[model samples]
Structures are given as structure tokens and as C-alpha cells.
Target: ILAKFKSKGSLNLHLWTNCDRKSMSPTTFKSQLYTHTGERPFACILCDRKFIQANLLTVHLRMHKMEKLYLCSTCGMSFYSSGALWVPSCNHTGEWPHLCKFCGKKYITSGKLAGYLRCHTGERPYSRLCCDKSFHTKSALNIHMRTHTGEKPFKCKCHKAFSERSNMKVHLRSHDKS
Candidate 1:
């Protein structure tokens, strides 16, 4: 049937079949019927988003109300999932759960491992619109933006403003002389 559809150079096949158990497998036909009918059994009570499986619905519920089931033994920190608790706890005890394949360096979380991998790849995802320069982190990119904008956000008691905090600290020391 699929070969005939492909031969015609078009894929507009109307699959209208009688309820014959011998023609098609019951399990396959049921799944196809569900896809066409949009029959989603599992539904979220909070958002009313439907899922085919109950386990998917249960996982989706976490976004609405996260229940902290796992607790860190070392820091007493609670996490919604076991993986979240395990990663930071490993970092605290100097235990590297995840390792880099390129440099043999270790990281507690997969996210840290991914960021470290970018250093080897030289892939800076954060970029500035004003300049062609890029940074590894958003905070670094934000700080770099102040150089272009000349934005003095930090202020002192003397009403003196500075672009960077370290510059403001240096200015404060001159006041100490008096």
C-alpha cells in the first residue's frame, strides 16, 4: 500500500478502513485511530494540557507545583528532583560525577561540564549587538555592554558615580585621606 502511494509521486493517501481485525493489527490501528481522533487520555488539572501517557502528565505537573522530595544530606537543601540534589552535593564534597572526554577534567553537574567543553571548542554563545565580541556567560556580556553605553550604575555617598565597582572602590580610598 505504501509502495503504491510512493509510485504515484504524491502522499495524499486517505486511509479509510473497515473494522476488520484480519486487515490490520489491532494495536497499530488503535494507535493510528488515536492520532487522527486526537484522543489524549491523560490530562493536567492545573493547565488542562493533555498527554497520551499518565507518566508524561505527572512530569508536566512539576512545572506548575514542584514538590521537593529529595533532600541534600550535606547542605540540608531541598530539591524537586533527585538529580538536582545529587549534582551540587557531589560538588560540595569535591566529588566529580561528570568528566570531560577531551581534557579529563571533572564537573559535578552536566551544565558545568557543557560550559567547560565550550572553552575547548572556543564556542562563545553570548554576543554583543554593538560589537563583534562574544562572551562565555551572560554576566560577562552585560559587563562588557557598560563599556559601550558608558552607564555609571554604582554611586557613592559623595554623589560620584563610576562604571565599574572596582573603580568606585578606588575613588572611595581618596576620600579616606581626608
Candidate 2:
């Protein structure tokens, strides 16, 4: 069953395995396959970092010259993405507007609420094709992929690299102490 065929007598095109033709076209479906395959075709010319999609590469490139349009009024912290600015803004306001329908748990952001819903539903949409490891969020899956890709995105002034940002932040403390 390599390819599903209609008996219309024409040669059928076999889609790549793990592609869902029902939801998306073959081209778009193949593009998303990069995530599971760890095929980062989109590269950041400045840093030589790669991404699975153009949009993700676009977002990453913004960090190099971040405009910081979304600012936290309370702390003066700024972000290129509005979603990134939401946490501090909600924390300062002490507002939990988004509520979970299943558990009635209050969350500051709808994204958090959606994540919480996944907990209740046990739905993990993002999965690693290599190990079958699944994650509720794509970012988490991407981070998990570093184990396989050996991609240490977090780098230090001394050229030391880390898989996790927090680990890199902690390593940076040693630099400060020196």
C-alpha cells in the first residue's frame, strides 16, 4: 500500500510516507514533513541556523534586528512577538481571562488554555518521527529534536553551546562571575 490509487487507469502519484493528503496538498504536506524528518532547509544566513519552515526562519531572523514593537508597560520589557509580551503583561495585570472548559482552570493566555486542554484530552499533535516522542506544542518537539540533531542553539561568548536556553543562561553566570 505505498500509494492509494483510484482505478481510473492513470499512473498514481505516491505521496511520501507520513503525509496526510486529506488535509493538505502534497507540496504543503511535504513541507510539514521537515519537522518530523528534522530536515531544516531554511537557513539563517547570519548565524547559519536552520529551520523547518520559512515562517520560523523569518521569525528567527527578526531576533537579529528586533524592532520590539510589543512592550510590557509594567517592566519595560519588549518583544518582537505579541505572544511573547503577553506573559509579563498578564502577570502584572493579575488577569486570568482564559478559562478551561473541561477543568475550569484559569489561564492568562488562550495558548496556555489550549495547552491545558491537551492535558485533559491527552492529544499530542507534535510527534518525532525518529522516536515517536510526542509533545503538545511544536516548540517542545523542536527542542526535543536537538537531542537527535545535536543542535545547540544557545551559544556563549566563549563559543560554548547548550541545548537548553536555561542551561545557557546558567552558564552565562559563570562568565559574569569571571
Candidate 3:
């Protein structure tokens, strides 16, 4: 199954057959089924995020609670999950595992490479249901959603809130000038 044909109404593909297990427990079978069927029964209480397993949902809830469970070895930055630490580690390791075929641009991860390719192809894959805005990456769409939710997570000591980190940084510059 190719990435481009994902939404093209299933190319009569039984590619999910590779994951089928006959001797596994019912719980294990259910998890494997959800991977192929896209069924997420475990939902977040705080946000729109859904998970196939309860433990993954628990890890996601930590994000809403601002729980720093994992710490970066290179930097003191904290994250709610161990998986989120990979992006920051790339800065310290200076490793480029993926490369773009269109351009000679180097990326830290395959996900970053996909985003760079989006820029080259001018494809806005992530879209907002609330508005007509579309974004090249899901992160950009997530940031745009803050505007509708009125969520200003980036806060300063003087009690100013900003939807975007760049906006908060600009505001902090004003504080330094005064």
C-alpha cells in the first residue's frame, strides 16, 4: 500500500491479512484489528485524540496534564511520552537519516522529510473542519486549532497568553525593551 493511494477508496487490498493471527488472545486480536480497521475505542477526556489501547490513552492524558514523564539526555527538556523525545535528540546527534529526492535537503527524521516534500509539491494535507484553512503539516493544523479553542498555552510571567510560540517570543522582546 502506497502513501498516495491511502484515501483512494481501498485498491481492493487485503494487505491487512499479514497482521491476522489465529492463536492470539482476544485482546491482542482486537488491537491488531483496530490497526487495520482504524477503530479507536479509547478516547481522551481533554481533547479529540483517540487511542486503540488504554495505556496509550493514559500516556496521552499526561500531555493534557502537562506531566513530564520523559527527559532528554542531551537537554533538560521534558515530554509526556518517550516517543516525543526523538525529535529533540536529533538536534544533539546531528543525524540525517532521511533525504528528499526532489531537493538535496536533509531532514532529521522521515516525518520531517515528508513535510519538506509537501513544501516542494505544494500539498496541504492537514485541513481544519471548523474553517477553510489547510496546512502542510499536522502540527501547523494543531496550532491553527488553538485560535478556535482560545487556548493560549504559551504564557509569560506578566500574564500574557499567545496561541503561537513565535508570537509569545515577540511579546517577550517587548518586555525586555521596557
Best by TM-score: 2
Query: Tens-digit lDDT track for model 3 on 62-138?
Result: 86678988999889999888888888898788877788899788888888799879989999978866899999997
lDDT for 106 (candidate 3): 89
Better of 1 and 2 by TM-score: 2
Model 2 — which ten-residue stretch has the worst lDDT?
1-10
Residue-wise lDDT of candidate 2 within 81-137, one digit each (tens)? 776887888878788999898878899878878977888899999885699789888
| TM-score list, all predictions | 0.37, 0.64, 0.54
Off by over 4 Å in 1: 1-88, 150-178
Root-mean-square deviation of candidate 2: 6.2
Candidate 1 lDDT, 1-178, residue by residue in tens: 1211112344233343532222134444445555445587777786435665555666567645766678899888887666677777777878887899998998877778887888889889878567899987655676787799776766677888887779999999999999
When superposed on Cα atoms, how far off is each prediction in RMSD?
A: 15.7, 6.2, 8.1
- Candidate 3 clashing pairs, residues 3+ apart or interchain: none
Candidate 1: lDDT of 110? 76
At residue 45, candidate 1 shows an lDDT of: 81
Error of 1 at 108 (Å): 1.9
List residue ranges in candidate 3 displaced over 4 A.
1-81, 84-89, 174-178
TM-score of candidate 1 on Cα atoms, chains taken together? 0.37
